[model samples]
Structures are given as C-alpha cells and as structure tokens.
Target: MLKGQPRATSPRPAISPAPGASEVFQLLRDGQPRTRAELAQLTGLARSSVASRVDTLMGLGLVAPYGGAASTGGRPPSLFALNPGARAVVAADIGATHARAILADLSGRELAEERQALTIGDGPDAVLGWLAGTVGTLLARGGLPASELAAIGIGLPGPVEHRTGRPINPPIMPGWDRFDVPARVQESYDVPVLVDNDVNIMALGERSFHWPGTTELMFVKVATGIGAGIISGGSLQRGAQGTAGDLGHVRVAYGGEVVCRCGNTGCLEALAGGPALVAALNERTGGTLTSSQDVIELVRSGDAGAVQVIRQAGRDIGDVLAACVNLINPSVIVIGGSLAQAGEHLLAGIREVVYQRSLPLATEHLRIVPSVAGDRAGVTGAAVLAIDHVLSPESIEAACAALTTG
Candidate 1:
C-alpha cells in the first residue's frame, strides 16, 4: 500500500470559479440542455461572458454538456444540464405525534422515506435524536452518504423564528421554544440545515407543486391543533414574532370556558380541533372516540352524531376563516390535515360560512379546496424547502465541488 501511495500524482490546487458561474448555472438549471446562445439570451449576458461562465461551471462538474442543438445555417452548439445525481438533500417533518424523514434528489423527487410515531412532548432532545436517526436511516437506505447531502430542511409543529431558525413557544411542542433546531440537526449530519413551521412548509410545497403562479394562498391545517400558513404575493407572511398564522388561538366564542393549550378560553382550536370535536361527539352520543381516524370512519358510516359534530366544527372553522378571508383577501384557501379527511362535509360547511359571512368581493373568487397531498403533505413540503435551497445556483456549485473527487 505504501509503494502504491508513493506513485505521485499532480497536486492540483482547487480553484474557485468566477462569480458569474452561479448565474450561468441557474440559467442552465432553468433550461435543461440549453445552447450557449440561448443561455446568453435568457441571462442577458454577452456571448463571451456566457461562454466563460459555462466553462467554469463545466469544470466544477455541477453541469455537463449532453448534446448539441440543431444547426440553423451555422455550426451546431453544445447543450448543458444540471448533474442531477451530483448531490442529494434530506428533509424531515416533525409533527406532534410523528416524524417523517425523506431523502430526495436535486429535483425534489423522493428517493427514500421513513416514518415513525414518536411523542414530541417528551422534550426536544428525544424528538431531535429520533429525527437525526431517521434521517440517517433514510440516507443509508437510499445509498447516499452524509457527505453527499447538500442541505437538510426541517418542518416542526410550531411557529419558527425565520431569522434565528428556532421554535417560539409553540403550544403542542413542549420545551421546544427557543431551541436551535437547525443547528442541532446540522450537528448530527454535518450539513447546512433550514427549519420552518410545518404548515408554512406545507404551503411552500403546495405553491411549488400544485399552484405555481397564483400569489395569495392560505393553507389551514385542522389536526390535533389548528394553524394556517399565509402566503401573500408569493412570499410567506411570518409577521412579527413569526406567529402570523397562529389561528388556533383565535377566539371563536367571546366568553366560553373551553381552555386551549395556549391557556386561552374559547380559542378556535379549543372548539374545532380533533380532540374537541371527538369529546363533543362522545358526550352527545355516549360513545368513546379516540382519534380523528375514528371520527372519519364514523362519519363515513353515516353516523348522524359524528357527521353533525364534524359539520359544526367545520362551521366554526369557516367562521374563523371568514375573518381571515376578509383580512387577507386570499384568492385560494387550502384545507389540510387529518380533519380534512372529512372531505365534503367539512368543506361544504366552510364554503357555506365563508360565502355567508365574508364580503362578497372577498368570497366571490375565493376557492376553498382540500389538500391533495394528504398525510404526505408535511414530508413533501419539507422536501420542497430543501430542494429550493439546494438547487439554487450557489448551492449547486458548492455542493457539486464538495461531493466531487479530484
């Protein structure tokens, strides 16, 4: 081995490419296998400048020539595209009762995924440790190493400080407030990490996958708790203190005595959330209902009491959402989470209430649709976040070089 090592190879010093390389890579990423002239046209750069940037990107292995364009009375031009297999990303969604991990390619397609039921209320340490292990398992199952990851995106069940990337007194996730979730995950995987509220990430996924161009969108999640992710003008509206979409704490009844996790009485979540609806139904029908799944089954079986409970919850949720519509004037409202499984019964009430309460203009063109992502929305949303960050020009170049062998 020592003799084989003695065979000297040239010590090639790594050279950082010019700044324009990133812009060039972005253009190529946008247009796969685009001709140099086409790239120049798209980027508004001179031919010579585009050529130099392309050469730099090619040297970095972030992009490669695939084929040549058809000649139009001139010499054929070479085309280039991103090296899709050059890097990977990890995404995790940490919910109140479960956590999911996925390994995805640069294009956001999941290569491997894993899920486990883990109580997040025990503390941040236990939940985060489980998350890290799940991520590692996903990477190993996908045949990718930690070094190949470009970044990790995390979705947690709480309001996240976008600037500090920390949870902020989230009601369901006890002891998670102010914890540096991104840094903690990064410590385990040795990669860049990004964290955001779960519903916000779900909104991102919806925008990236389903509604591409429409701007004003609201994603309401009615699960064990209620929250909304507001996207206005193609940007997430976190507002001051990162609690813009904490609709769970919004008062539904003025002086009622139903206390919420936030210590508030008559909050919207205290009325419409899964446990509340189930408790109400159990009290009415004299039957035990454990989870949202049970409630949905009962409603599907045409149980009058269950159907009525869900419908009433829907009305209450819609009343709150009507206020949101009037305030935000969102063009589309997406209802998601376990409660959304009620389908027409829930949406009908919500639609009916919104039309009845909100201003005509606000409700005129507003479309209330159920989520298509279903239970996978959180995982998919987390994956979208990672892909958006990792596939950026700068990140692509950096990741390519980091994963490349000279």
Candidate 2:
C-alpha cells in the first residue's frame, strides 16, 4: 500500500467524524477491493457511515469502483480502490551538477521526467528558473495540464528547513541560504511544496520503494561529498537543525591536513570524498581526471590505482559509520552515489572496517548493500513525499468538502 503523508504539526489531525472518511479512504488505498461491510467492521463504524464515506470518496474522484467481490450468500458487493490518475505531483531532485524532475500521480507512479546539466552553484534564481522551465517541459511531455497538479516535492543537495521549504546555510549551494524555494517554485502553480535534503529523500525512496517494512536503514552517499540519510523507527530522522546525517563534516581519526568546504581541517569529506580521491589519483598518476564518473569507470575496468584508492576511501567511510552503526543499530546500510558504482571494491573495504570495529550484536544483523534505485531514488522519493502531503487527512478532508460542495 502507498503511504500517506502525515501532518507535520505537533498535534495530530482530528478524526473525520462523518462516516470515518479518512479511515475509509485509507482502507481503499491498500490496493485491495473492500466492501462497505468490511470497512465498517474494520473501522467499528456503521455500514451506512462506510457507504457515505465511499460515496464522498467516489464523488471526489479519489476512489473508483472496481469489479464486485464474491459474497457469502447474497449478491457480491462492489469493490473500490484509489484512483492513481486523479492528481499528479511534481518531483525534483537537484544535485550539485544536474537537475531532474518528474511528473508523478498520487500513487507515486511516474508519468514523465526530464534531466539537464546545471550547477546548483549558479545560485537559486538561475537554478530555480531553469527548474521551472524543466518542470514545464516535463509536464508537456507527459500530456498533463498544470491544473491537475496537487503539489510539488523537491530535494536539494543541502540542509533544508522542511517547515518553510528553505535551505539553511548550505555550504555547496551558494546564495541558497534561507532561500524561499517553495515560494519560487509555487509561483507558477498554486500548490503545496515540500523541500528536504537530497540524501534524506533518497533514503525515503529506498525505504518506500526498494525495501518496504525496513524500519531502520542508513543510506550513505559517497560522491563529491560524503553524507548519510538516516531512517530510525520507520521515519526520516532530521535532527534539531535538520542536519542529522551530515556525515561529511565528521573528523577523521587520522588524516593529513586538508581544508574542507565547511572550513574544517582533516574532515572525512576532505580526506575520503570523491573529489579528494580524484585529486589523489590525478596527482599520483599525473592524469587530469574530473568528476566521480571517471573514478567509477577506472574501478569498473579494474585499474589497480583506482581500485586501491576507492578501497581505502570505503575503509575511511566505514571508520565513521562504525560509530554510527553502534549508535543507530540500523539493519541495512545502503551505499549510493556515483563512486558507489565502483561496486564490490568499495563495499569490501566498508565491510571490513564496519564488521571489524562495530559491536558484535550490531554487525550480526547488519546487511550492507548498494542502492538498487541509483540516481532515480531521490526523484522517486520526492514524488512519494508530494503525494503523501496532498493525501494527508487534513488535505483529504478539505478535498472531500470541495468535491461535495461543487
């Protein structure tokens, strides 16, 4: 079943007393055909109330009647399910080097997508403008009208104030500190917007799409920067300042002097990040190599120099994550990003240190693997986030009222 977006407020949303509409909707959303009698029994509401809620959902075009279910003795009752085509959300994954967007339905199914090479360092105005155009082109390609859009979800490669949908002192993303990203994106369309950390959204995608029922997971991205996405108890754990998984800035146990982007010396990112690895290789072999892609290809072709560097880099990452594993006790550790495409060499090094250093209990059930979704994880997670936000009980109540009044 597709997950619904929960309210981001302190107090939980109020229950819809009228026929348990939200409850009924969730029942139908489970991708199974359910009868009013079954819903009533499950929800402890009257059959009449269940029927009323179903009527409201159908009226709003949120639910559709499917073929009938077999009956015990009487005539079979009709079944209902969520209408995936009722509304769509725009999902954007903005990286340091490129931007991608997708048009997805309420069920988190992608209908259209587009990508372009652009740098986040170009600042918000230029990037967001480009983003707006990219979204427009994608919507056109999908044959979807902007009027059908319910919300927008974006993942930026930096810390974000999730509440206001703004970046907060992003080191790599210049001129984006406290930028009104949601407002800028929403200007073209009147809809709710959700902005969050790119890695966090990637973790969400892994959990929601690839590994359902995984309540505890960690997504470590080894790219131009080294960062982690933390999921504890089936929810993303954004710390007090929305930088819980800012693993790049962690101090290495033993490292040579190298200044980091955050102005720290001997930081993990400065020592073992993609840029650091690439610089080390280029300096040693007197070869000019740019981007993590080059390093990934070298490792893929079994270059001893590249393989050795990546293996050491993975060990360095594991050094930091060993502590994290002890603290978080995640069952799964998923390594992603461009450098992760180097495959087993990286994984082997990470495994060596993680298992050697972490507690026996922690390592017993831990499973370290590569991301199956790859680059698409962030956008897919963003799409799911948008759909969930628009389908929350509060939003659903408002939508139902609008449908009934109209």
Kindly give the number of clashing pairs for every candidate: 0, 0
Off by over 4 Å in 1: 1-16, 253-255, 393-406
Q: Tell me the tens digit of each residue's lDDT in model 2 across 143-181.
A: 888888889899999889888888999888879999999
Note the Cα lDDT for every prediction shown: 0.81, 0.86
Return the TM-score for candidate 2, rounded to 2 decimals: 0.92
TM agreement with the true structure for every prediction = 0.89, 0.92
Q: After superposition, how far is residue 224 of candidate 1 from its true place, in Å?
A: 1.2
lDDT string, candidate 1, 1-406, tens digits: 0101111223334654555577877765543577888888988999888887776666555566665679888778877777555578888888888888889876677889888898889888898888888878888899988888878888998889977789888777889989988778777888778888999998887766788787999999999888998999988898987888988889985529988877879999999999998898889978888888899999899988888889988899998999999999999999998899988999988998999999999988899999977777787778877777776766756644553443
Residue 206, candidate 2: C-alpha displacement in angstroms:
1.6
